[model samples]
Target: MTAVHVTPTEGVDQPTVLPASRRDVVLSYIALTKPRIIELLLLTTVPVMFLAAQDVPPLWLVVATVVGGTLSAGSANALNCVVDADIDQLMRRTSRRPLPRHQVSTNGALYFGLALGVVSTVWLWTLVNPLSAMLALAANVFYVIGYTMILKRRTTQNIVWGGAAGCFPALIGWTAVTNELAWAPVVLFMVVFFWTPPHFWALAMRYREDYAAASVPMLPSVASSDEVSRQIVIYSWVMVATSLLLWPYTGWFYPAMAITLGIIFLIEAYDLRSRARDTEDLSIIKPMRLFHFSNAYLALLFVAAAIDPFVK
Candidate 1:
């Protein structure tokens, strides 16, 4: 394959050309937004609106929730990239991202993130409900300011607390439907809270060197794999317990799905933890699989809740 090279200006020795196969500047920009993570968060949000309200929320409401939440999440991820770009440039996984690759300027990222954030908040407020709008704003702040900026470098537990930023979608979507906060959504929030660490740390395990090089202090870089694996198991068990709590609140069908999925997650966690006696890279491969599956598990459980009204 021929490389597309970007030549630097007069003062710079070499110019950098971004990946050439991609077109659609908009798509590149969107890719910078980390759409998969946003989609997972949104997946948690939308179905809960239906579950909490016992039917599909208004079509306008759902559309508003999706568009607005996505924008907010996109903005948050973009800003995170901007803030961490220096460190990101050192990581093999993230080095190719727009910011790290020098394909997008910091100023451009900042302006785009803020523009998208404002538009998202406005759309949610105008079309969905004020509470969801507020929630979106909070999620953005929690991530960009609270988690990424402040806590990430300070503690190995960064993801543990930082993950809270991602949980607001459940509350936002629920309030969009019910117009008030309630315990059921709170339960869902707790579920995600417990789920984040093991999921993220599993990936971090593969990239510990990158994190160490970046001085990011993520769990895998900061803690022993044994410790991380232990935490994974503990959190996985707690996550399962949390899922069981939703039985009375969300509905029976959701509880069943939750229990079933939770058990599967626990087994995966156990496998990850048990294999940590030795650092055989191959042993923990399944943990990554679990991390990916956990995202789907959470989404499917929420979808079950959404459909529970008819069955009940």
Candidate 2:
């Protein structure tokens, strides 16, 4: 006898029959971890470690922290996939995920996520420090329970506050080095917090229909293009300002790069707002330009921070 499963198809609940293949099973398990997201998170983490050291950090500590952070972030992302499987099936953007495609069982994914979470804590505690471990655990819990379970469905402000979970890498990186937190990491944390809305909202604008189909009240899906663009500009300003706050701790080189990169980010953000004011058509709006630039802006800015310590 063949197996049958029911999954959401483009907002309609329907039955799908898919046989899980061996290679697909392996890939599907990795998909639950969301490797691209982990890459971005590590981009923030390692650079902060460099700045925290103000010199070369120990090779062993950096490797350990990266490994531990990977496990922790992977756990959060996997659990998120489990919780959002229903909505994931509904939206075309997430329709091909392992859960929606029946490539992985929910219970299996759930246990995998849990086990990763426990291992991350122990790995960080034993190799990094207790504070770093605790920070990772808190971020894991907040992302799963606070953001995915509570805010994602209930409000349009979901990613704004929920993005705090991503900000933990700065704290974790700093603590992994010095075994304590400071204003420098806090400033970097605020930069990420403020940056999340504009970054996510731009992508959300491109996928507004998918979000609407899923009944997820993302700002872009529920709000007008003008309103969303306006908010993006607002957050972009705050994000750039918060980024500058790190200059005092860094050096002249960091501020110079921050100011230059920030100007480019603002230019792109305002351009999006201007285009949005003229037309609601996504084709003309081209929000993804800003979306892609934002990613580079962040990566470059953090890279500058990491390099400043050496050049200063």
Candidate 3:
């Protein structure tokens, strides 16, 4: 096969070449799924499986659950790219995505998403359990219909409730282990639920004008910086408080880590709030500081949750 070559178009920052080989095509489709986002979802997942088992789960079960969960999230994100392609083109942050770059057509992305969704559902049902399969499907539906289709363009609070879709991994992880739901996983679910708003809002704060230009009403785009900051602080407190609820079940280590992480999280939130209150220049706000930290915060917290049972 001859290699396809791409060069930059005059005045364009990105290369204009299409995929030249089967490998490039496969990777382009995978890129449509937004694998980084899937990693975070899996971060919340694997920890809960360990916590649910109260020990390490079987190696095969862990591998199966992670694979199924990745496919499910990939489906949802690919569909999201399809649905959001229009606004995605308008936002500098997302303008180079496969759909906007024409590396993947809308129809192709849609079909890929649906196929992954179906495959993941069947994989979970056969290898894990029917309940876990259904929950994965429900998360996909909720994200596609509830968040992307219904709420994204319509509301300022889109991410707050839309984020419920991302919380399903904790439940899916727990069920994959115990084959049933329990209160501990529910607490983990809420931890991700409350964590979503502040985490997302910080990024939205940095990209407020991009969202404004795209005409999507993310909270940061529609509200005052002070208002957005206040809400971030509020949600930070709530997320920290919710993390504490696992203490009775998880014991000292989880709570100790929670309190320690929560303090740093609160400090960042408050620092962002202070900057918002004092500065008129949005560039000075440094919202990405909190955004990056939130990612680390959640990853570390959940890892601690997974390790808590072994210590006790």
Candidate 4:
């Protein structure tokens, strides 16, 4: 294949030539999937499967669910890249993504994403269960059509509600085990639902100018620092409380981990709120401290949940 040079367009600050190398093309397609975000989604997934089984789930079942979930998540993220391509070029944080960098054509990414969605549905229905497949498909549709197309640019509460799409992995994981829903998975789902805003708002706080430039209405971009931090504290408190609701399903070990992790998460949230209350300076607010800690908090909490059954 020959290298393709794309002319710089409006909203795109730099023109980039697509490399002809097969490896680069493959990697560009992978980048369209936003693999890091998929990792976080999967972290919530596999643990729930373990919790549902209350033992090691069949290795093959675990592998099949992971593969299906990856493809489903990749489809959603890739389509999001396609839809957000124009604004992505305007935002410094997203300018390097494959769509904005001209590494993948819009139509190419769109078709690839659609294809992944189809394959994931079929794969999950055949290998995991029909219910898991349906849940995964719903999540893809919600993330792309509901969140990316509808809510993201229109409202400051985009992440708060749109983040529900991300919460489906917990449901998918649970359904993949029992072919149905339960209060346990529902609680975990809400934990992730509440966790999403504070986690994303913190990152948005750091990239407020990026979202503002992109004309996206992320809360942190449009709201006052005090308002954003206050919202974070509020959501953080709710997320921690929701997490403890799982204590009824798990043993004492899980609650101990949940309480300790929740306390730390709350401290970081309150600290961010405290700093924001003191001043408007982004440098002093340090929202990313809470942002990074939130990642660790979610991962460790889920791991503890997965371990609780065995220890009990």
Worst ten in a row by lDDT for model 3: 1-10
Could you give candidate 2's per-residue lDDT for residues 108-174 as a string of tens digits? 8899999999999999999999999999999999999999999999999999999999999999999
lDDT of each: 0.80, 0.91, 0.90, 0.91
lDDT of 4 by residue, 61-117 (tens): 999999999999999999998888877777778888888778888889999999999
Residue 51 shift from truth in candidate 1, angstroms: 0.8
Model 1 per-residue lDDT tens digits across residues 1-312: 111233322332223446565564566688779988887988888888888778666887788788888898998998888787766666667766776566776787788888999999999889888888998999899999899889998988899999999889889988988888999899989988988887888888877877887778898888787888888889888888987877886557877787788888888888787788566464554557767877777888878878887676
User: Where does model 4 exceed 4 Å of error?
Assistant: 1-13
Off by over 4 Å in 1: 1-15, 18-24, 280-286
List ranges where model 2 is wrong by over 4 Å.
1-21
Please, what are the lDDT tens digits per residue for candidate 3 over residues 42-155? 999999999888888999999999999999999999999888877776777877888777787778989999999999999999999999999999999999989999999999
Q: What global local distance difference test value does model 4 have?
A: 0.91
- State candidate 1's TM-score: 0.91
- The better-scoring model by TM-score among 2 and 3 is 2
Full ranking by TM-score: 4, 2, 3, 1
Question: Lowest summed-lDDT stretch of 10 residues in model 1?
Answer: 1-10
Clashing pairs for model 3 are none
